[model samples]
Target: MTDAFSSSSETVLQRVLEVSLKSNTPVDKLEELYQIKATCDFILEHQFAKVALQFPDELLGDSVAIAEEINRNTNAKPFILGDTSYGSCCVDEVAAEHVGAECIVHYGSACLSTSKRLPLMYVFERRAVDVDRCASSFRELYPDSRSNVVILYDVSYAHAVKDLVTILSPEYPNLVSSELVVEGERCYSPGFIKRLNNDSLPPEQCDSQVIYQFGRQFSLKSGSSITDYSMFYIGEEGATLRNFMMTWNRCSFCSFSPATMTGRAESISVNRALMKRYYAIERAKDASVVGILVGTLGVADYLTIIQQLKETIRRAGKKSYMFAMGKLNVPKLANFLEIDIYVLIACPENSLLDSNDFYKPVVTPFEMEVACNKQREWSEEYITDFRRLLPGGQSHVPLADQQDESDETDVSLITGVLRSHNLLNGEPAETPSSSSMVLRNQTLTVANTNSAASFLAGRSWRGLEQKLGDTPVVKAVEGRRGIAIAYEEEGTAS
Candidate 1:
């Protein structure tokens, strides 16, 4: 047993050390992959004085070399950013703003969420792909030449997509390839824009012909619905594939992995994910206290959605608290035992948190909306992006009025107990003037009205205690201390 434990410990230590080591790549290949010349041109054209270069953990091995090259070519001062405040996929605008950087150049895999504050650029770091192999795999999986299909790919493999389309388009005329929307470029598809402005068109005619999700956009052929198409993504398995699977659960989905150089059909249970989200919504509806966790500051209109969620919770007669903790973990969230449930307001890619390790259920803004707003109805069309819940978005669901049955009660599905609708009444629960005794588990205890405060009070270790007058005051004395690593008394004790 001891030998096995020691071996595992040594393996973990080696992996930790390996993370700090840098992997070397040739200079010319690095420059071509990162498009150093294009980045230098962008900096020069913008006349930026200070630029922050952000790289995800995997790509950080080459960050120093890339920064030095950019500094040599461009007049702008370049600095490499360390660990990001939130998800690495997001552009760490908050970190860039702290250094007063005029712009940011992000590298590696990105969520491509729109940044609100700073001007940003992305370098996908082009990856190699065998177009012929991918073409052959596509034909095998999709034997029918007239099958309705849409081709989407990871941004790293984007450069080879044009070649793949050229090779496959000749035989398969129904094949469509989606385009990635870059910064400072037109966002909405032509069909989407046309349908939006044409209010006089009938309901069926006004429905969008273009489908947009995350950073990619594609239009369907006239008279064909989105449900009629099958999605084929080219990328390694990760959050991007999961997001695509959940968002378009109705469509048939498959993926091609460039690393393995093989194509395989994905059998992700989209219904299972949606069922879990629905369960979270039901749990939130029964919660008396909701903690609104701010997961991002870079995504556009985050503040607006936070405010909207707060108001919605208020109208539902529930208590809410806002937190801005950098990144969420079990320990950070566990510290707040008072909160019954948590609502995470983050970018679409980072919003869906796996709550298996969390003490309480964590829900997204859309789920919170369905729980608090009586007007909204649950549907299979799940939305992870908080922006879509904002006013004027396609999935926007309005909050219920304050006067709508504020005092009604409903039975909780999980706890089979009647819960009051107006338990908090849009205010913090206050301690009653007189305490009542209750028998719980054969023990008699004084019951307090403020459940949150009572929970903290019951904890044995309730932080540091402040005894104002119980303890006698003592004179100040010099303490033996040096630095944190080594104390002054350590040498004398030795």
Candidate 2:
């Protein structure tokens, strides 16, 4: 008994795993690692049993490992779901082989093996159906009644499957419910789902519940939508942002990362640009928009609240735009939402605030501001090739350039105040290999003991109140002195 107990405790699951995650890491990370791996293994084992999905031709590079994993698990004589690379039920022989059955069938075929209904696996790859005869003849021989359909596809394809689950849930609740697993999470078919928009439904409900509980376990609250009414007021869990999620992008300037995320940038840009375009065109709102549904206000709980706002706006007859904010690591949201332009604000740009690191030093705050100003300038400078995305000639956006504002800091310290934070060439991968990469921020200047812009190369201090007895403030521009403020008691206004 003692030996068995000791051995079991030594396993990864048994480890006490007392982790103190930083604000940038998921607090429930250790537990998620524990759960995500186990779930993946279970699904892999079942898939290994039957259809034997294989690697498609488009897969490149070290997919050999994935191919080999498929080969090692699949048995010979497994069924083929399809031939096309991206077709629905588009699984290869090896990935399918990881399923519990020897035959991988399309949604129509999936219904016959067990009951009046069955696991209608939802996959992205499409293929021709063998509608000639029912599988009764084959089913009679195997005599198995279980229908375990697996819906395997990239998360990029989630929106496609989103509607399908609505119908699938109610149509075959028990049959479909028991059979599906997606991305290591229990995925319910749309038919089994009673309502497409409800937050309380199964699978999605379970997903949110788990994430919320786990996020809290790590001392993080997922970010939620910010509303004019909810400002400084208590909000539901979903509408609040996770401090850690914001920090995960871990920008020292704004809450989220900017230049690093292309999709996010594009999405935000496209939405805003498109809206200006729509307004310019004087597009009239029609009654057709009545059927449109705004995103639930509380969506900030599960998804990025900013993105949710864009979707809600789109539904309300505005142009499609992506929302900003969050520590999202995937481009799926940006792509799925059809965003074209993204504007980021996580650098030493605009107001005198500085973020030491958005991690990539090349993109500094001043640099980001420069980039944005350049884009706007270029738009006006060369509107020829540029399709006027926004309908109007120019947009009147709220900017930090309020006329009444002034900086009281010493003018010498604010060098490069209008510089851009992006690469001169604007290459996507902002860095060269280690051969050319340099820690540029190390050379940047910050306020020091005498309160001059001394150079420092590390994380920034919390808003200047702590380090200096006095903090800088915007002045009336009466004397024209800049970047320094006359020191005062703590009660002085910023």
Candidate 3:
């Protein structure tokens, strides 16, 4: 009944369609592929009672096609749990349309919220945007959960799920009635997983950190991996996916951005395009921000992003501080991103301290946490950060209006992961000392004081050199100094 990609909503989609048609196969082909895969998968695995289809809110057209394709390709028919009434004009239709059989059913209230008891299940677990909640709320399905509660994880949430699933499975033996459905070939390394879960935190984690100075922050653990560039591997047992986090449409023309020096828009057009159409995120502010870069091309890619951001921030003012994975190529990114401060997320590749890389001040995960904590409204802590003024309020947020709403005490699933290790990092650096990129006598600063990164490293970690080989601190980035972070391309600053 509803029209496909309309002018108001289909501008982006239409452009994508145009590109796909001339460059690749028709958009419909993707759905055909899904239909085939789904049909085969279902036939091979559908010995169970029902099937649950999970995807983001963007897939809503061609529900019938998907069903038909599945039935057409497979020996038998399978039920689909999708409702056209609950459409989210996205490419997910590529999967929806081809599922062309009547065996599919999302029979309730046209919407996911309204949908009723129709045998098939539709799962959409986007946070806050949909308070409807049932999309992926997994717990004991009760005396009647035999119907395989297939939990599907795309690249974004896949990595996070891998970690959380491991931590939680032991506790939810009865809860997991069905097998876990992790798609998107995003493999993560065992080292990263082990490192993230190494620290001690409660199940309902309360640790989120200041990404950099100037109020920028992100979760230590996002339920999603977000980036899916297959070139970016997380390691063994680590879910691997292609990194498609960069948005290119705007990058081509950005001159004021510093990243342009490191990564030409021409080279990163693919990164930008993938992010724009599929999964691009930008800052939400008009203020200057700080950003950090890391690893091989990671710094280069992020630098280009920061440069574009700076061009936009000048008029607005939200500039980002830059840092790197290790000390490797910090200056290349720092200058491009205009990072006022620096922090090292990891030295796995030696980006921070290497002579080949740019010079940067020291930063540690703990310092970054301090900066992030500063922005928190501290809505639900039994204790407040205001020093007994409120007695049980351990929160000190940067905003006035968000104070109460955030106090609801809703800790995200990833919050616990942040609490374990210091998600924040920072360390001071002298301006152009002797060999590094010589500049005036300015010292690098950490963006946030949210948590005490300096203090955290003191309490938890001691010898950075002893623990992590190749990536030494103090020389390039001092141990326990601190680290900074940046905003996404969309200006969706936090």
Candidate 4:
């Protein structure tokens, strides 16, 4: 018994040393990229019975190492998940559910879409940055400027933020850093914001505000307000930068790359992304068949959003089809030629698909709402995350229990808004005898083709004549020049 105890202790110590050596750089440098201590602390605190540890393909090598550390320190069982069904950035809830994981610890770059069944904890990838060099570069770029500068950064460079502020404090007295605010029951990830439009919350809490920064506010005053503060982002130009620009387009912003140690103005790129989004929104308005691409099922409240979309499309007198494939690629979606537009129900990061290369225009849920809802005027306030579609609930509730407002007769389908309308083209639209109108909404078929329905109902239509009731068949005469005059020859030949 004594020998066995000694062997086990030595083994544990060996594992600890191995991990320590692997991450043996300065504490600041080691923690900058991935917060090993914080991750373990979170796991221990949650006391989750089953935990799913997700890592991107590039970071998969560190999975065993991370799991071992967590297992050694806590009682939670860590299941290493790989090759997400959808975009690698989005949380793979399907993978987590396989192991019956209660929560997910996502590592690396994440789209930050809300989770469905499993709550998620994100460990953003951190890259080392030379704080002094960045501070020096800023001084050179804006030497004459005296306004307060707000430091915004990609999740990957979150660790370098503190060092940056410290290095630049002496030179720039008003340098401020922005931090994301998270308030929810689930474990909050770095980039994800809480659901904004949840109706269950009281009126005071129902207001949608995704990004909250704790830096100086922009202002036009002689003194610096948050509005007047110029943005100094520390990351490469990509989705995060694009989203940030769209969120604060009016403010002056600059993109700085810690990897390359270079900076560039992002006004042109920001405008271009906004312009493309606006164009896609306008094009979706004319679509007859809208495809609701179920890009993710694991996202919390996705089903609610899907049902809402179906009703919204129907009210707008447009046919909607649901497509569910883990990954939404252009090649796969192009197969559905009938769909004029596709609204991707994906994480906020991957939701705004660049349709420049796609055969059909793909828009986000926000754009879909704008296009399908006639009364919805275009607004600068844009929301792409699925959680923002509805309020967060305590637990997943049955669809039947949820209240649906579409049953109300006073609602107007043409305008896609709720309002009382007694007449349509000077005729009573409904007089308690409008069964057809009611049935139209209830029995709407997936396929709008008349021939397909007729063929299924034992009827002979032109193309399907061979399948059903007898219809005279014409024989082809390849060598005959007067075959066009078949009607004249029919009576004579009989």
Candidate 5:
């Protein structure tokens, strides 16, 4: 019995440390996987002296070896960057700049959002896929050869997309495969550029030939709309799939996991998620104080979005605060109890924060726009990217035409209380005069101010308070000084 128990414990321990049991990858294979040669060429071509190599947590194991290889191949100094200041999917331009890195080479899965300052090179480590199995799974899910299907995939399995398409195109004529383009002139599709340049035409009317969501771009049949087609995703379920689903919520989705070698129809609906976002927007309208949380510094136009959000909040007659703390959690946000709602400006994939774990509700920039902009209206279409909310983007709503709705009085559905929008106009509440004072059950009850500062003032522990001039001052006295581990006074006594 004792021997069996020990053996079982050993098995569990091995399972827990299974990642360590994997054999080290060969140098030659690692070079190919990380595209070390290409990275070195990019650095040398650009004449970058200091190069920053950014890797996600899962890919950190091979970061050192990859960095060394790059260092040996090129004259540029290579520095490994981990614990990214923002989402790992984005290039850590902030951290790269800290070391004065001239360029950033990001490894592992990426969101492909454009970086602001530094040049970025992505090394999506190639992962093996059973092409035959994938083709077979595709056929099973989409049996009709003429089905209007779009093939979206993870960047790691991007190498196999060509072969998969080659095999399926012969039979499936209406198949469309999305390409992940990060940098260079090919970054934005023609349709995307047209939409950005021309705002007079509605998005749907602005060339339905192509569609761009997040960083993935694809073209549809000449006359067919994206809504007319079904989406077929190749990769494990993750942020990529979730973003895809949210963006093209109208299309039916089916995903095939290479790891599991199984294909299934995606039944997860974005309707519930959309409803939650709408609810957050409604809550924002009722908020008197808003917190603008900077969730990313790498994505292009992040600063512009931050400024826009501030201006929008100000125009709404609400108090606004900006925070740039790296990474967000309950404790960090809970510290700012005065913030009625937090508007997270981050990459699309990281924007929709789950509010369940948070003390205060967190919302995306799009939702914030709808809540703050009285001219903006809620619709079936939802935008996750902050860039689209910029001045010229399709979803951009100008604040110039906004009507003054502050004087309107209505009841809050959330609080079920009669609330006045005028309370959020940043005007100080009037103090009751002594002549109008009335007794209420032998206790004084003041009218609710319905403001964040008023809420904080009512809290039991409103942070440390300095009673200036109230407490008597004492003469200073010398105290024993020593290291934290062992004090000098204690050592002398012993």
Candidate 6:
């Protein structure tokens, strides 16, 4: 926390308890809500002497109370972390390091990116939703639904899932629940499923099919393959929904909003995003200087992705620079006029920044890889997880789909769906300026060769010059045609 917001650990705990009492929140549920018991158990199991408690802005009110409870129950010393360097969703490992804490216990909504150094124990916030009504809406929306109905939700709505299952189990026979078998924090998307393979299946999934759980385990009544299952998401139109649609575009999907109490069929709107993403990819290929924005340091495997991106840019014969700012805003980036494109290495949730209003385009690390890798082809598959982009995690592109080396030059890299077409007027746009198409000036200049001291040593820095009218200054003073002297009298007097 900042200095202004700082309070004694005991005072903070007392204030949090007061706030908790006014809300009529149960004291017993506090342990489950914050996962206090599990977090303490984890500390004991690991025998960590020092533990850090990280909370988002909204969760700060409960931080002190949680820390006190942890300190009381376990032998570990619990310390509270205030503000974070980047997005609060990421574990504030740097803050923990300041206190010499061993690990972090993160609370509230998370991006679920793996922590690089400090091991993170995430306690996602669970808000109560009307499961009975939500299930009724699902039942009425799709009467005689297929056996394969996979249920997914935002981490916030994770609590209602069990009740939703109990209500819909009788009507929907094959209700599927998923737990991510992959490493790191679980993302809010179905793309994690594509990363699933035979070798990566968890212990419970060993004998079962190749299907891995997305969030938590929802045991199917009977064994069934992942075929025509309709994905029913209990969240909003966010990153999770975008990822879910991208992975299972062919399958029927419906999103039921617990807040609105409304259910609607998700059409090809998700497809529109695919086109936008492709357009961004095409634009990235034309960029000369790419700014790699360190969107997140908290997500696991971020450093690996940054290294891969730099190498990719180098291989493509382009230049790249690294930037690290906790938060990214258009104005902050606009200062760098030389940068043509910015590739964000952020959490998938915060990734895909729309640079339409920006002076330059912004892209993701995945897009950077696509633009630079000659072996990569434009595909429908988009990777949001950086861990998946690692060497072993990289998905193999089919040989038939890979582009040949010779064809790379002949193909128009900038030719995309938006080319030659004007969105405003229903007519062809004028040709782009030559300056826009020209290659960046890669020539480096020597500072000493054009030094002011060397040039002005012989020349006079004064007003009106010479036989000719006032002349412009030249680089070298060796052979000058015209001269001016404003301080002639002062020089003579001195």
On lDDT, the candidate that comes out on top is 1
Residue-by-residue lDDT tens digits, candidate 1, 1-494: 00011111222111212232244667768767788888888888878888888887788778767876888898677766757888988888877776668988888787878775777777886777888889888998999999999998887888888889999999998888887763343121111111122344346435547766687777787789889999999999988888888788899888899888899888878888899888999899888779999998888889999899999888775778899977799999999888989999887878888998999999999899888887788877888878888899889877655556555566788878766555544554455434422322112222223455666767788877897899899999998789866787776443
Give the TM-score comparing model 5 with the true structure, all chains together: 0.80
Q: Model 6 clash pairs?
A: 1-82, 114-300, 178-213, 178-214, 179-213
lDDT of each: 0.76, 0.24, 0.27, 0.62, 0.75, 0.64
In model 2, the runs with Cα more than 4 Å from the true position are 1-40, 43-48, 52-59, 74-225, 228-271, 276-494
Error of 1 at 348 (Å): 1.0
Could you give the candidate ranking by TM-score, starting with the highest?
1, 5, 6, 4, 3, 2
If candidate 4 were superposed on the true structure by all CA atoms, what would the RMSD be? 14.1
Tell how far residue 129 is off in model 6, in angstroms: 1.5
Candidate 3 lDDT by residue in tens digits, 256-357 = 111121211123344433322211011121111335443222111233333432332222222234443321444455333233344333211221122224
Off by over 4 Å in 1: 1-23, 182-208, 406-408, 422-451, 464-494
My TM-score estimates for the predictions, one after another, are 0.83, 0.20, 0.20, 0.66, 0.80, 0.70
Model 5 lDDT per residue over 143-225, tens place: 88989999999888888898999999999988888776554532222111211222343465457476776777777766888
The Cα error of candidate 4 at residue 189, in Å, is: 7.6
Candidate 6: tens digits of C-alpha lDDT, residues 329-435: 77898766667688988876677567788888888777777777756676767766556667777453212222332222323356532221111111112323322
lDDT of 5: 0.75
Candidate 4 lDDT tens digits, 121-221: 87888666777778877887668546577788776776677777777777776666655433346756533233332344345433422224221122222
Error of 3 at 379 (Å): 16
Question: Which runs of model 5 end up more than 4 angstroms from their true locations?
Answer: 1-24, 183-208, 402-406, 409-411, 418-494
Worst 10 residues of 1 by lDDT: 1-10
Better of 1 and 3 by lDDT: 1
